[model samples]
Target chain A: MSYIAWIISIGNELLIGKTVNTNAAWLARKLTLLGYDVRRIITVPDNEEDEVEVFRDAIKRGVRVVISTGGLGPTFDDKTSEYLAKALNRKYVINDEALKLVIETFKLKGLELTEPRLKQAKMPEGAKPLPNPVGTAPGIWVEEDNTIIIALPGVPAEMMGIFENYVEPKLREIGPKLHFIERSITVKGVPEADLAPIIEKGMKMSNRVYIKSHPKGHEIRSPLVEIHVYVSSEDVRKAEDEINKVLDFLIFAVKEKGGEVLST
Target chain B: MSYIAWIISIGNELLIGKTVNTNAAWLARKLTLLGYDVRRIITVPDNEEDEVEVFRDAIKRGVRVVISTGGLGPTFDDKTSEYLAKALNRKYVINDEALKLVIETFKLKGLELTEPRLKQAKMPEGAKPLPNPVGTAPGIWVEEDNTIIIALPGVPAEMMGIFENYVEPKLREIGPKLHFIERSITVKGVPEADLAPIIEKGMKMSNRVYIKSHPKGHEIRSPLVEIHVYVSSEDVRKAEDEINKVLDFLIFAVKEKGGEVLST
Candidate 1:
């Protein structure tokens, strides 16, 4: 199973630069660590048309999982659930389970639910509501054919809470069981431009392992670069050994080019 | 003159959770402040097929300007310039100006140019190379019909240098001349759910001004919210006055709802 995923972050704030979209990065890290190939991280505005377009685009690409954050609030601009339903050609209605969760949450705070509060319970029909232990709006989880669609609140705490509590477990069950291994080493005294050919040779030699170099110092003087070596395989020991062998080869090659390995 | 812009960040490191995409956020902020309506921020791997597909999609969407970062280096994985040429149906060739820039940069450091270093000079036909003051790769700039396409190196310093020194001036000449004004006021003792109706009312009252509420405190207990009021208009005074009026109304309405304004 190819366990591919896409993160669709919906918010005008993100588009306008009011927010830095730490949410997307956080979710990307989590999905990658879970052995899913997170292929795209997309951000669009809160507009319903843009939201629907991005969602449909993800579906057309045939990714295994689609996760969206933001716009699941109570304001008029909060339209992720409704637009997602539109994109899926499903009915947008208040889920009874979601309503119950909202009522219980508000009741615990000694408050009564209102129309604005009721908006938190609305979701696409036939979707299951993931309980938000830290916030009011319940997260949405629905499966279409082979893809799993999820919507979480924009609040970092709420998004993290629901993701860790519900989404992680479900994803683990559906995703491929692959072991991922990675290692990084910093090299100095060699410019990244000069190190490129060696990296190319290393990648060609070990097709199973991926080697990426990040330039850390000035290209002209005091050159520094961080090379990341990683691989994934069905066998844990095989993945680990492959990465180690690639690292060894790359380290030896860098030394041969008069580059100093600063740290690993 | 809608001034629509899109930011494309290319890297596998971003997808694999090895690096955070701070470049996209920084560019989004710059574009927004320059009066460009940044519609989307897309991140993809270093794969050529993905890069070509995204570039074609952006062109098809008819955005005014498309700025892409990363994959403009010398490594095998760095294919942004070549794929962008293919997407535009232009020849991928070495430009004389870019080659001169690369040669001069290396010469200043008392170093000799090699094939890997020469790779940084290749760009699409009819594209102008924006000199990279900090790195080897010269940024690519090309125009097709009504859209402008640009590609910059992934290193933050190099990207920023080329953008600020070259791209910013060109963009300023083409973008809309609009003044943007924004203000934020934090309110405590009010849950975001309860504040939603007031936000809705405020938006209706001042449709020209955009009012967004960010939940700062927990939804149920010790509730705090930051209301951001902003507007953009051709007239600087008009934009400022409009946002201030909305802020005043929102503040007064919050107080009426028993919410205390903490900071502005």
Candidate 2:
């Protein structure tokens, strides 16, 4: 069975549309490739109440994994650590390892540790800090009865750094064994409305495979559509076979309907 | 008071990272510009149960406006309309106007209306169908007791066509009078940790103005950061004045700390 996951992206910049939320998309891609069924991608503001509420809600929903990005900074609005502790009913304390990492990072710059810099070391009691190789604020990892929550910095580079180095390996060990396979084929001269029945028949043929169409041309005139066929299953060979069978059937059906298969 | 808004982006392709949710970002930007305080952006798969659950939850949360994109198509998995009717406890029916639009679209394509294509006209009992300028599926608009829900097609061109032509004008008429102003300035040579106190002070001086710092450079070395200052108020002049005041103070503070003002 695929493990359920939710991605919480925290920042006022995202809610206000100042940022495009590429972090959520990137995480979703990684999680999906790791065989985790990402159920939700929630973007909330930097407010403590909102952050804590989402964290609690994720736990209540019993998702196996929860990954959040943003609010792991030294600014007054960066409250992910504090609010996560409140949500988990844990004491907010200074973690020794996180503090040492922060001190070492600042020491490299030939500077003394200030209060704002030290704030990066604070996390929920019993939570572990994943060392950040490129930034001061380390990624946070918290394990609960039913959920594992990981909070990373909003910075693209820092978030990617910790996720690739620390989180990916651990998740790979525990993630589901499902293998996913997908293929896309572009068709011309066939409107999506006309191709809908063919897609429906294709889906009915294989209950395991999902077929979706994206129209690239005008509906009333020249119709160009890209059909995506994908499936995930415990058996890699079965998954591949299912995808190939459905793909061949779709190509044959499209050509039978006078549609030109442009590319696969 | 700023009206609260939420954007629900629907599609499995987005969840699996096959597509980036640019539709949500575009809608959020438009809503924010129209003086709507966008609170959340939720992305869910193309499942009827999940769609209905999120729609009901948005109503329970009492957001003033909820806009959803995707799943309005001529395929089997396109269930946004059906699930929305269920969520609102309204009988799903095909309206004459919507039927006419769908028939005309098919006629333009020199084709007869099939069952799957006809399914696009079905909507809640009291809903209105926004005319689609570029696509076959008409956008669905439903007004609840305290919430307004608008469902548009998942296709980027079609969704944008309906929203820009039909929905934006009506929203402008009923939206809040607040005007939002934002300004960003880049600074170098001052770490974000050191700039945190100044940002906190700037925020304290003006409760209405929000100031956020985005670190562009590494913390230990050449520290480069961009500071965003923004505010929204009923009075356009007051909003502009407040933003300028906060921006000036932040710039002065950054320069006072020996940070080079790269650009504004």
Candidate 3:
């Protein structure tokens, strides 16, 4: 079975360019490192209809895991939790554990608890509250069948804190057992076309080998081209060995073409 | 009608976490600043199937403009141009203008032209080749109805170079008459809940006003809360004036709560 994940970033700030949606990129990188195939990422303004549509579409597309960031705060525009509840057709209530955390956080900060602040405690029925030691708003983990949806705060620091402290470990526990590895060798001074035959030969030698080139600087001026080699396999150690062998051959090929490896 | 755009980052490096997809963020910022709603961002490995699936999905979801980055290289993995052609049901052919540019680039680089390098000149039939003065791979611009799909190189410098020189001007010309402007004010000392009432009043004062809270550094024992106020309007001056009014009210409310505005 193929495992896929979808990321949703919820914020009007991101949509309007007031804030960069770093959460999606960060999560995508983490998921990739953990061997989850991130199929797509969606960013929507704080709108119930748009968020619901994205959520429903992702579910229908057979995404095994759905990670949502942002709009979990204690304001009117922060409507992700409630909207998610509505979309999932689940009842929402003030979770005691979550409320306790919120109240304790307020007391620790020497702040008065307000009604909207209390709303942070409310969550969709059956959803597990992920501890948020970094913020008053707790991350939520909702599971239906085998598909999992984790809702995290939009703040980069808070999101990272929650993911590192709880989400990452939990995901690893439930994630697949497949092992994947990638390697890159930067090449300079060689035109990409002349390098293709060599890359083709390298790929033929290693089943997992792939090459990509990126041209740097202005096209009119002198451009620097860097070629990256990627290798992935079920056995990480074997993948590394295969990649090293290919890299050695590629370096020789570059020199033959009057170019040199930028660096290994 | 609200304008919506989608960004597709096509590369294997992005999938393996070897490279950060900065192009998506940069393009998102640009599109947002231009008053275009970026609905989603999809990053797929340099696989034809995944590329076609993502492209079809984005188009089905009604994205007016789909900007694809990467996979315009002169290698076997550089199949974005071909896959995109299949997705759009168009024939792939080498355009004379693009061929000339590719040959000129190789001539200037003092590199012998090879078959794979010549493939960089091929584009979907009837597609307009966007100038790529910085690299051998030229960008392709294809339009069907009101939806526009632009394919550009993946390299950050080349992507930005082509965007600034070719894409941006064309986008502005075909884009909506809407204008976008935003301002953020950071607030500290008040919990988001206690600040909700003030935020509600601020929102009522202006239809475009929206407030979001981001919790920062919660794990360090003392957490800081940053609230951002965003306003979007078709008229720049009106938007700025309205945001200022909301800022004034927010400042008054924060001061009433014995809190302070960190920045305006």
Candidate 4:
């Protein structure tokens, strides 16, 4: 069976359009590459009630892993840890491991461990701390009702650092491993509508693969449309072969239309 | 009262990391500038049941406006229009206005109205067709259960064309209008941790203003940490004043910290 994951991006900046939410895309890509199916990405504000509701709802929706970014900072608006505890009906307390991470990070940065900073250590009972090397906030990882909840800091750099150093390895050990192979061909000058027939025909070449065309731009300086072919399976070789078959047909169609493949 | 919106971006490519979901960010920015709160941005695959569930659930959550982008093509995977109809319990039919748009678009492109292409006219009953000037698939606009559900084509150019030319004007007539004033102050040669104190102090200048510092990088060549100051109010001047007060203190602090404000 395949593993399903969901992302909940918690930040008012995202809802207000102050931030573009590059974190969801980054997490989705990482999870997908690691053989997990990232099914849904939901962005909510930093409100405590809404955060608790969304986090609980994701679990109710039957996702195996749920990752939330943002709302892990020292500011007043950051309340993911507190809300998450309430969502799962767990006790909220200052975990010593998480507190150590908070204290060490502040010491390394030559900053005092203020009360606001110390609040980052308060997490749900029985949750493990995912150390944040680049920032003061420590991420939380808890498993409940057969669902794994992972919360990362909102800052993109800190989020990426914690995921790469801690979460990725942990997920690799526990999450399902499926093989995914994707290929792309860049075609210039042909609009997506005009290539609909060719794309349809290319898709008929492989039932195990999906072929999608993304229109980049039609401007004179950037006349390129990218066709992506994706295949995933339990067997790496089968996935690779399926993707290759779809890509071969797509590349041939692009070349037949007098278009150039910028990348293979 | 401000109107809340939710975006449902349907496509496996977005989940698989093949696409960056620029449409959600674009729509969120537009709605926020026009005085709407985009509470949730959800990304799901092109599955019919999943789409229906998400659409129905968003309305249940009390968002007045729900917009979905993608899966409006003539391809096999294009099922958003059909699923949206099921979600609202509306009958599916070939809308006359939508059919005209599909025929005219294909006629102009010198393409035949093939059976698959004709499917673009199938829309929910009683829904108004938002003409797609850029593509064959026309967008659908429907009012159901006190919520407005809009479905746009997946292609960025086509989605944008319909949103700007049609839906935007219609929304202006119905959706709430809130003024959002956002100002930016970029400081060089200072880390976010070092500037957190100043940011906290600047925030006290105005309770109506919000100041967020985003660390770009710490290296000498890329030492720009952008501080965004935001204010939203019914009065345009009030919003402007609030943002300016926070930005003034922020800029002065940056200068005192041996940094520069590259932008106001």
Candidate 5:
């Protein structure tokens, strides 16, 4: 991928460990599959000042796309949309389409539409509405400097439902065509230190391959370390070839080090 | 807590969804108990440029403490210590104590001490070594500009071992004395919009209480929304009293709104 993507998970629950930031992980996987090199996942608390600073900095850092989840509810604390509006220097307005979505969602739930409920419809000016089928709040999609910023609800079901149904189609249409392939090998008795030089050699041999090692000492997985090699390209065959070459080299290196290569 | 802390979870596995960042959640909870306002969790790939830029920016932002997990292994990709050294403009040097610990760990494991393994002992100049009892790599703890930067192993067992044994005690010794209390009430049939006004009133009525609402629409959880009221103070009694006040108000308001209050 030519550009880097980012994920911002906004909520106090995340900071407090009351809620795990699974939204960031899930989005990262989807974006990577779609060929965006996801650079960072920033989990900020539900505060306007912090959100605004982080969001603005992300854009300033030349992030091509940023998918933010949380703080879309109709409470005083849920200010992610508002903070994003300020960050983008856009007015917080009641988008007609988003208002329609909120009204429709409440009707479907047979719930009352109070004045505060209308706050759910407020989004940054010029943002496209991403409708949520599973919840009341509608997501916002804004584009500035050719950078796509998507703001989605915090609730897991609602966030996933909107991202898959509405956001995924938009991304597929605009995102560059790319495919990624990955292969991993687990090596027991070999530390990453011993495996580093061989992995470095593999990196020099391959053009697009990215190799990483995750060490797990003595807990459950018998392997002391796992080496993952990934490659992305427009052609599926090219990606597969690049990843496989690195994986093969690492496996052989593990064998030479007197380590058991667990995964084929 | 008076100071803001952050977590930087490194490694490409986290970004690719091959690994879920349970370490960040675990650290956040631990720091919260240590009386720190855990602010952000940044998950970055194992690239030096990315790591240096992020680590520098975080320090520039004046985070009181930064706890980073992953990338403390003995691999070419493990560059957290090197990046932190560059970020702080300090020389990366091999700490004698850390080298001793690494050599001892290898001896205990009956593993060969390769030259590549020696890289694990290198740390930012003037940083203290937090020994890892469960793994080879010793954690690096550096204090710069009054900001405490801690670099721990990516491996779950090693990371937890260092944090609990060494980092935890240090934080406890230096961190301010404070205690927090949280009381949450689940309300069915009331959307966040309807609860917002009451929550705003509760906020005004208390000095230390912080109220937040989590919406879960038609999920396995029975309640549609859970409003959490939290308070922190040096005095445990003050925190308890403040949380109880908000909890009482929320319960009454939910009842008035014709919503079932699930918690006592």
Candidate 6:
């Protein structure tokens, strides 16, 4: 079974240019490394309706796992948890474990837990609270109809803390069996078309080999074309062998065309 | 009227972690700087069904401008233009201007225009072709029922070129009359709870003031709390005065409580 995951990055700071969203990219990289196919990464503002719509859209697309970052704080704009609960058609309740974590966090910081801070404890009914070792807001992990929905705080440190502590382990348990290997060969002094025939020949030899070309540098200058060879398989050894064969052929082909392979 | 924009980043590389999605972040920063409220940024794999669903979803959310990047190439995976046409129920045809641009681009590179390469010319009927001066793929600009949809090539350089050349001008002409201003003050030598009352008092005096506390550093040391104040309004002068009043009070209160305001 092929596992597909969707990412929803929720915040107005991202949309308003007040802050940069490194969360989606970081998560995409992590998920890909973990053998889960990140099908989509969506950024929605703090608006409840838009957040809810994105969640529904991911579900409709048959995403088995949905990881949402941001808007799980005590502030009024942090509406991700509420919208998520509403989308799942579940009532919002303060999970005891989340409440305990919040209280402990406040006590450690020597701060009184205010009403707004208490709001962080509220989660969707039947949701499992993922402990946030770094912050007061606990990440919520909910399972519905075999789909896993994880809600983590937008703060980078807290998000990472929760993911490492709870989400990562759960992901490994349920994730699909997959392996991917990639090799990129940078060719200089050769147009992409000149290398196309070689790439076509290589791809024809192996069904697992796929090639993509990217032009590098300014339009006026001699563009460097980097060809990426991707090989994916359930067996790691087979995937690596497929990638190695394509790389070997690509290097030879570039030299045959009187072009140098700058790097691989 | 407040304007809301939606960003749709399309690619399969994003899902598999082959590529980090820098497009969404860059687009968000640009839209925010242009004073447009970007409501959502969604990343989806290069799937026709997902593309169509996302387009419809963005329209239903009443977003005035929808900017989608990627899948405007000649490959089989590049189905965004066709799906966009099917979703809008518009006819699909080879836009003459776009075809000319593609042919001219290939000719400049001295590359033979293959059948797949020529496929870049086809676009949704009635859509305006936005010039991609740097690349072969041209962006498509479609306006339907007051909502504008822009389809740009996935290549980073090509997307930026088309957006800067065509889309930005059109967006500036029809955007909303709204502005956002933000200021942050770092408070040292005090816990957040003690600072909350002072901030609350300041907020009660000024309706436009918003205070957010961010804790920094690891668990072993005392975390630094930085408070951010955001003031948004159509009238710049009024908003500035409101922000200044709160800023002055916050500084005074922090000083009285034996805490220093690092900066404003």
Instruction: Pick the DockQ winner.
Output: 1
The sequence of per-residue lDDT tens digits that candidate 3 reaches over residues A73-176 is 87788888888888788998888888888888878877667787788888888888877876778988887666788899887877888999989997887777
| Model 1, runs deviating above 4 Å | none
Candidate 6, residue A200: Cα displacement in angstroms equals 6.1
lDDT of 1 at A20: 82
Instruction: List model 5 lDDT by residue over B27-90, tens digit each.
Output: 9888888888998899998888889987887788788889999888767778899898999999
Clashing pairs in 4: B35-B178
Interface RMSD of each: 1.2, 1.3, 3.1, 3.7, 2.7, 3.7
Model 6, range A124-240, lDDT digits (tens) per residue?
999988888876778999987757899998878889899988988878777765666788888888665456567777877788667776657543257578788876577988888
Docking class of 4: acceptable
Against the true structure, candidate 1 reaches a TM-score of 0.98
RMSD of each: 1.1, 1.3, 2.6, 3.3, 2.2, 3.4
Worst 10 residues of 5 chain B by lDDT: B215-224
Q: Can you write out model 3's per-residue Cα lDDT over B1-264, one digit (the tens) per residue?
A: 547898888876665556666788889888866667787777787888889888877767667999999998767788999999888888899889888888888788777778888888898888988878566688988886667899988877678888889998888887775676555666666666677787878889987766666555342254356767665566778878888888888888888987777776
Worst 10 residues of 1 chain B by lDDT: B238-247
**Residue-wise lDDT of candidate 4 within A73-124, one digit each (tens)?**
6656678999999999999999999988877776765667767777889999
Ordered from best to worst lDDT, the candidate numbers read: 2, 1, 5, 4, 6, 3
lDDT score of residue B114 within candidate 6? 75
- Candidate topping TM-score: 1
True contacts kept of each: 0.70, 0.71, 0.48, 0.41, 0.66, 0.41
Best of the two (2, 6) by TM-score: 2
Better of 1 and 6 by DockQ: 1
Q: What is the per-residue lDDT of model 4 for residues B1-264, given as tens digits with 9 covering 90 to 100?
A: 438898899999889877787889889888888778788899999898789999999878677889999988766678898999899898989999988888887677676777777888998999999987766688999988778999998888889999999988878878665688888878887655557678889878887787776667742234678887887678998788778767777888889988877877
Error of 1 at A227 (Å): 0.5
- Answer with 2 or 5, whichever has the higher DockQ: 2
Clashing pairs in 6: A38-B15, A41-B43, A43-B41
**Which 10 residues in a row give candidate 1 chain A its minimum summed lDDT?**
A172-181
For all candidates, what are the clash counts?
Answer: 0, 0, 3, 1, 1, 3
Best-first order by TM-score = 1, 2, 5, 3, 4, 6
lDDT of residue A263 for candidate 6: 90
